[model samples]
Target: MKFRYLVAFVSLFHAFSSWASDSFIVKDIRVEGIQRTEAGTVFSYLPVKVGDTLDEEKATEAIKALYATGFFKDVKLKSENGVLIVEVDERPAIAQISINGAKEFEKDKLLEGLKQAGISESRIFSRSLLDRAEQELKRQYISRGKYAVKITTTTTPLERNRVAINFDINEGRTARIKKVSFVGNEKFKDSELRGILVLRKPDLLSWFTKNDQYSKQKLSADLETLRSYYLDRGYLEFNIESTQVSITPDLRDIYITINITEGAQYTVSDIKVAGEPLLPEEEIRKLILLKSGQVFARQKLTESVKLITDRLGDDGYAFANVNAAPELDHENRQAAFTFFIDPGRRVYIRRINITGNDRTRDEVIRREFRQMEGAWHSTKNINISKQRVDRLFFFNSVNVETPAVPNKTDQVDVNVKVEERPTGSIMFGAGYSDRQGIILNGSISQNNIFGTGNFFSLDVNTGAINKTYAASFTNPYFTVNGVSLGFDVYKRDLDTRPLSRVGTFKTETVGAGVRLGIPIAENDIVSLGLAAENTVLGVFADSPQRNKDFVTEFGKSTNNFPLTLSWARDRRDSAIWTTSGTTHRLFGEVSVPGGDLDYYKISYHQKWFYPITDNLTLMLNGEFGYGDGYTGRSLPFFKNFFAGGNNSVRGYDLNSLGPRDDRNLSLGGSKRIVGNIEVLFPVPFMKDDRSLRLSAFLDGGTVFARNIDFNLMRYSAGIALTWVSPMGPLKVSIAEPLNDQPVDRLQAFQFMFGQQF
Candidate 1:
């Protein structure tokens, strides 16, 4: 019996030990070795709970779950007295990151990039993440053509299981494109192709353009441009075989080679329109730019499709589609095309939504919108709405979209969004001229005061020769039909004692006026104004006889009533950065019977801009002014016209081109003529920046005391720069007198800085 009991005891003890080795019934859970993480946090990630059978698979899964959290570098699980204990060796957190020897990029920008790569401070550290950060840095440098950049990283262990990372960089020279060549081309010269490319060898403009730098993105874009050039010129079968970019061993120079096949040019043999005709077939055919016997241009074909789709869109087909299908005759080198039109549905605008206008009232934007709710969606109206709002100059950008309404097949919503800009400004500027001396000026103006779309301004200008104080207010929408009302009060003082221009005299005037503007057409306005003024003239012995006679006839103090009539037509695409269109203004001011002086002044001004290319514009501006006395009275010399200034003909002294007195001093003129032809383009290498402009201009103008003489006109040619800086619009010109007379006072360099109203 003693031997049997011993054998049973040994077998039972072995079985109990085997069960504990394979699995366990957990009674509790414990987490250890975590520094910043809480025990409860580890328990939440634990796949096994207490009182559950914890086996080998469950323990492995639990360790994987904790490890995947990235909070720990190692995890181990064990069971003691039916309690599962999770032990984790937490990874070190990043305490700080520093970069050294970085000159090409901002430190904060580099830190932002590293943060995107999961290597920022306070984040868990990992060797793989560090490698990723290094690669990101390399990518940035490579994009900038810095192919020889070297980056070395160091990580130091810190207290509390933390790490500080440092990146030492050696940014080398930028790899420039040394050569670009073409292969397998017969029709076009290599020079022509290279000229069309954005990438080029170093040139005078390379310092600003950086076009000499070799970049994959730039190369790819060049390839696309080259392809487009071919396609637009009837090379429909052109194909690029291969492009090879080779860098020198030192990575400081790059060579690009392109192989292409320019197949035979094709002509359009025939054209037809297919599918449902939303409009008359003849009308649709008229919209097609490509005709039989013309070259097959992809650009023209694309434009034809767009025209058709736009026409359909105007007819309420908001999602119109037009695709041009081409049939080729390889032997004849001719192509026939068909436009398939798909007018999906007639859609109406269910609602008009406005957004991003925090300061402006909803009605302000709504009033500018031509597209109305509950009406058929019209692309033309929507575009007009966007243009109207943009022309206000109150917003940086205006975007419009017609998104289809959910669960509705024939309805869409117009979403008009705007980005408001600073519409109010306090301007302070100073300018100096030989005649005007030092001119100091300031103004406070708001184009959209209190978001009401009204304009208010107070202006003050003081100079050695002139002083003016004025305040004006305009309510653009005083009436619902776009009639505008404006009021202004002003005081002007002029002292010509120290100037050699005109007669030496002093004058003080005060005036108040009210004006009404009536919108006569979509782009035309008629303005009528009435003002009353009182003038006091100080005519001394040294004054000109002409001025003394006028003072004697009209007395030292006199009151005058003036009536003003003006008409304006503005069709420019934009008031600022105008690239195309024309503007015309016809103005006349007449002193009525109640005034001490009876005179009239009439002027006509016109401006036209033609876009020669995407980046080039041709502008033509002209102004003609004529003034004379009525009722046999003489015209006031002070009201006469003056030319030869920065605003008129450059390369001459300010207000210096006119009839001269016997003393050779300039006498004001009763008539003036000014004309300018300017070729405007973006500043070299700064095409993307819209605030700067450069123009080559030719100017011709002259002022006449009585009769006009074109032969007496002065001419100048020069280059001008316009920069819309934070302070104001700054203009500088360097001109050469083309046809200056002996009496002309030449001024080659002129600049003016003033804020826009």
Candidate 2:
């Protein structure tokens, strides 16, 4: 009321002053009472100029215009010696803003909000804007269910016509939803309906999800979800009549009530394709999800439209539209839907535009595109191209858009934008195991060297049991047809005398190899390689007799040429987080008769991922290996396969499962089998987050020297977590041996970093 009276008094004084002024001609203009605003600024807003006539109306207009600038709190006009004089009291400038007792949000965030509301430092202050900012701050707290929050603002005057503003905030306790009641839900239980809502009463996971908070936006979204739930379950006429939310007197609890009306369930009586589908009627009809006599589902109807539209898009109809028009028979509660398809135009790619590759070359990305410029536009091909680019692991995000070319009905441009991620790293890593104590390794690698899509790496590792140095280089696009060429050189020294789990021996090897990767299919690749190796054996007095005997028979040093062949087909949607797809790998290695050692090894592995729900995935993985000597020679013991580790069978000691020598030491075998089943899901309350995953797994595997025995396999069950952190991939697991004999060595906990297990 006081502020209103002040405004009224100011208006009346301006009116009286304007009516009393006499007509006069202005000689010059002068401004006073301005400390920060320039005198010319005041003159620029005045309606009366030096030569213009000044009258009672002009006096009124000048004052009004000057006040409207928001720079002045008071304005007065007068004339002296035929000169128009303007005096203004400028509004105080804000010198500083400070927030106190703010715990719910960062101070910078709150200050930014105030700035958006025109209440920032160094700006002319307005009482109205200050009040509005205060209210907005309260509203933000309310959104987080803090109903008892309070904010008190203070202004301290300073020299030079500036003021310091401070906000004293008390962010009270956040209220939790005490009850959520439905008034008219009958077909489905209240519990079942509540399960679909994002908001809920406080529960064990509420601390992480914060779903117990009552937010207006969350409620609105929940109501929409409720409407969709009913409509998707054949209740096409469902209506939400009202919603009510109430807070307790103490502001510690909230209650919600939603009233809804569920109409009679409906069934689909018929489905027909009506418009010019551009394709065969049978083919378009086959895409319809609604069948006669089936319950009407809005979700299926929506999916049917999308499927038909996408089918048309695959056929170069970039802007196809599919509308399902429904006719309702109220008495029988049946709906007849006619899908109207309008295949707008057959369009071709006018251009393929690429952007956002700050480091990668344009050719590197363009070569992965399957959809070519000047060809018919294909949505399928564009999507495939996006997947291919994503699989390169060179980018953090890949986005593709097919926008119509202006003024061209039959042409579209494919715009591909990608967010690049760092593809080069120099990492020094360390790992620990019961047997390998602490192993340290370092590598300098670049997957996209100089933006040319080439790979290069130099690695060095030193451990208590082994030491290695290696160099590798690969050109992923060695040819236009997606063939790859790579070369590797490595030297390794291994000594097993310090380990109790294996027959003790020592070996040194130096090798070099070249490989070629040939693309066999869109998802299949075959690689071939050959390496020349020289290995020297060092047998000690305490070494197993088998190792000493082999050294004596084959001599202290031997030369061998080893060949490798591998084929892989990977279709996982994402290499980082796979939800649905299958991956298969088949590998074989042989040291031909020309080498001092004649042996061959072959292995096959398969992984299948299936989505059990939007938030759950079932993964099945199996591996098999068999290696033996050919041409009258024995398989080298050092080349034998080993089981029982984090990568093989969890819950058992590393390399602890296989045939044991007379001294009860592990002798790794010539045959191996491993199987694993896992149910994978994101962490609780983080279903949409892709960087972390948790899984419950069952694992079984064993190694055999000659015969394969199912009963000899070790089994374990456990839960594991994998996080794709900024530093690298981290995996941790806790397992319980399900069927371990007294002879089996058990290891219940394991973890690895820098790479996946």
Candidate 3:
């Protein structure tokens, strides 16, 4: 194509020289040799018009202008009988684009890339563009570690001066890293350094993790990890000199090497503060994590700086800057650091701007903010406000940014952005248990009803042993002072055939309750409720002696009034799949003296989670319960606590771990103690996923009626999988009772879908 253009240029130059002395007046203009292009389009680009005097300069200008449009392949100007004749050859338009054998990327993605490169349907086709598009496709494949990929483009001419372009791609296998080596390491071994990197050599697990595949982005992140490893270990002057990546001849294997300079480790000699201290010197010094004689760590230094900055921010210094300067003493292998603090002008918030919330009301979000408009800006309060909003679970993501107000040096605007998530759910679930047979349950719930931050739920459950229907509603801001009001109504029918030992009986209960919650602190809540229930005991010919005796004593139906008090402190970072923090709950329920069967129940639950690593967490959970009849009466057997099941000792049958009767039916106990230790980790291939979890657990628990027996305790070891799937949350467990006895029943495998864990 370049040669053709060169030849045309030479011919035009010669023609212009021969006609330089000749000039003619153009009577009319006509465009020829155009198939799809209009004559007016040609005239739009031509420099000369009809009835205008034409010369060599004018003719050359017209031809050059026409060629510059890129729509014409050839242009010529000729004069015949005092008329100007313009000739042009239009470029062929693209009719269709098709990509074949493009397994690495979707066809639409590749086509979009071509479209951006000016090679789409209905656009003028150019050979140069085809070559560029081919190169681009190859680049995309190479980024995926497919260095051996081949792309071939073909153009087929069609009718109406249009052509169809096809791209055939052969994406070869991804290149795998065969070896990764490091240099200039004195304190740590190569293995230790490799453990901190994301890119890894080929291993048995590489197929699932894909860590062996070579990617420039992964390599860059790995390098940063390597740098942080050194900096955090007192190698303050460490540097990565260079890195080299080599590929095999077949483009199937990769080798990586990194060169580094490990400087001498330094111990902190002294730490001091510089610049004006807005607060007390003692308070500022307490925020410093670095101390004399300790090993110098860059991470600790950075944390110290952040702490000082945040402290200043809490004092209304929103734009505070704190820098840590280190002075190295090479001779003594010691380092001295000084924190330089810059407490900028104190600023106030002029306005709070909320966006991205299409469903929820502005006040619904504003109520969660601790930082108020027109108040002095406190970074600590701003962060707390964002976290509180996140804990609402009404949005998928919440972000807050502060920008200085225009023309107001001491004022800033707070912008809060949120991405709303689904707040309503309807679920139907089924479960199988050896003792309960098959159980079916369904529920409809909404956390943010009508975007008012209220909650409502209706639940229905049926099983061989129990049937229940319940409804509840809650208003979080009932009194506008962080007080909550909720109401619940339920009806339950229990067939004691499966649970009773000697004989069979049934119990029917209908109840309603109202609860009030008061927030005393950020993480503490106190709740009080009153419930009234009517319970009827049905006695059959085969009823147990205990059931018949209960009916004979208290009559067939009994009315009771129970008052409940609960105090809880929840500090978990996330309500779902929590990785850290502790939760403590204490609950007590007492039947008033006027109740037919006066009884009291007390229970304490504590859960603690410790993050061991980015992908691993250790959780310890414990529960204790005690229930007995008040006013010198025996404890109501119906109010006893039962242990064993998915939420208890999972290896045993549900509610089957306590004492048993002659018929081998489980009898509920008045006292219960259960403890569990779990090591939670990510699923092997989905380590970064937040919605899936795998855990190994050891559970121990026991239920006692009169005397607590340690020998009767049951122990179980199990592995569990928890996934928050689209349908609902799912829990599956496979457990084995470590101390199974003849009387204990086992449900080794248990799975439940569409239920909250």
Candidate 4:
């Protein structure tokens, strides 16, 4: 193709040179040989116009300009009898594009990539462009570790000077890492350094993890990790010299080698604070993590600077600057550091600007902000505001920035940017359990309705033993002062044959409730609610003694009115995967005097999380509940609390841990106590991912009807996997009971899919 273009250019140049001495003027221009390109486009590229003097040089210039446009393959200029003729061969347009044999990537994604490479339909086609596009596709495959990928392109000519381009892609097996070797490391072994990296040699779990796949991005990130590891281990002058990635001849295996310079380790000899002390020097020193005689760590130094700056920011120094200057002592292998603080002018927020929220209302995001507009800037408040917005789960990302106002030294603007995510979910799931038989459940929920930050859900569950239908809605911001209003209505039908020894009878309940939440503090909420429910119990000849007595005393139908009061304080950093925080909730529900059943139930739940390491967290959760009849009525049997489930004791059957009836059916208790201690860690080979977690837990709980016996608690130990999958949140556990009785019900494996916990 290049040779043909070259010949055409040479021929046109030679033809123009022959007429160099002859010049023409006052002539009309004519264009020919253009099939798809408009005549106007040809004329626009022609340097010489009609009625303008045209010489051999002008003719040559016009031909060259036309060819440079990339719209034509050949260009010729001719002059006869004072008339200039411009002739060109337009490039063919791409009519269609087809890709085949591409499995690793979606068809639409490949098409979009081709479009970005100027190889889409209805565009001018050239052989050079096509070659470049093929190379680009190959690069994309290689980035995904598909080194054996082959791309073949063919063009079929069609009518009207258009061609159909097809790309035949053969995406072969991905290259796996065979070995990773490090060089120039004396203090740390190769295995130690490799453990710090995400990329690794193929292992038993390679099929599930894909960690052995060679990815350029992952390699780059691993290099950064290696650097950080050294810097945090007192190697202040560490540097990665070079890295080499090698693939086998067949492109199925890969080997990586990284070279580094492990500089001399240093210890901190002294630490000092310098510059203007806007606050007490002792207070600033308390924030420093560095100490004398300790090994110098770059991470700790950086953290110390950040803490000092944030401390100043809390006192209205929004633009404070803090720097750590190190003085190295080569002979002694010691380093002295001085932290310099610059408390810039105390700034006030001039305005708060919110953007990138197209679906959500501005007020919905603004209500989460703690830093008010026109108030003194506080970094603490700004960070809290960002976290609060994140907790809403309405946005994919929330970012806050402070930009100084023009012409104002002491004023700045707070810019909160959020990227909204889809907050509506529709889910359906089916499960089969030995106790419940076949169960089908579905739900439609929206956390953000019409950009109002309201939550609405419709839930339905149907099983052989149980059936329930419910709808609920909550307005998180019912008022400007952060009050919340919510309501719920539900109908449930329970066949007691499976779970209760009360004969083959059924119980039905219909209920409705309204609740209000008042915000007492930033993290505290007090709730009040009232509900009315009517219960109907069916009796049979084989009914149990307790059920027969209840039906005979209260009749087949009974009505009750319940009032609820609750308070909660939540300080979790994240709602989905909390690593650090504490949450406490206490609630009480009491049936009023005029109801058929008068009882009060009180419960307390407390949870705390402590970060054990960067990748591990320790969590403690405890729940206690107690209920009894008030005035003269006994506690309703249906209101009893049951322990033993995935959310309680994993090794036991659902709601099966308590007193048992004559037929060995679980009878729930009026007192409940459950506690769990878990260590949450990142799943192996997926440490960088936040959507998946693995936990080892110890759970103990028991329920009592009359007296609480702490020694009667059932203990279980288990390993759990939680994944925030695209379908929904999934939880799976395998557990073993430590203390199991002869008649105790045990379930070793429990799992729930397409549901949120």
User: Which is the leading candidate under TM-score?
Assistant: 2
Least well predicted 10-residue stretch by lDDT in candidate 3: 13-22
Ranking the candidates on lDDT from highest down gives 2, 1, 4, 3
lDDT score of residue 596 within candidate 4: 90
lDDT tens digits, residue span 374-435, model 3: 89898889998999899889999998999998998889999999999999999887765445
The per-prediction tally of clashing pairs is 0, 0, 0, 0
Span of 10 residues, lowest total lDDT, candidate 1: 11-20
Off by over 4 Å in 3: 1-29, 39-68, 79-84, 422-438, 496-505, 539-544
In order, candidate lDDTs are 0.88, 0.89, 0.86, 0.87
Considering summed lDDT, which 10 consecutive residues are worst modelled in model 2?
12-21
Q: Identify the superior model by TM-score, candidate 3 or candidate 4.
A: 3
lDDT of 1: 0.88
Backbone clashes in model 2, listed as residue pairs? none
Candidate 2 regions with alpha-carbon error over 4 angstroms: 1-9, 12-21, 43-53, 56-58, 685-689
Ranking by TM-score: 2, 3, 1, 4
lDDT of 1 by residue, 49-106 (tens): 8889988677656666776798987666767788777667899999999999999999
Question: Which digits, one per residue and each the tens of the lDDT, describe model 4 over residues 651-750?
Answer: 9988888877787767688999999999999888787788999999999998898999988899999999998887667788999999989878888998
Q: Which has the better lDDT: candidate 3, or candidate 4?
A: 4
Return the number of clashes found in candidate 2.
0
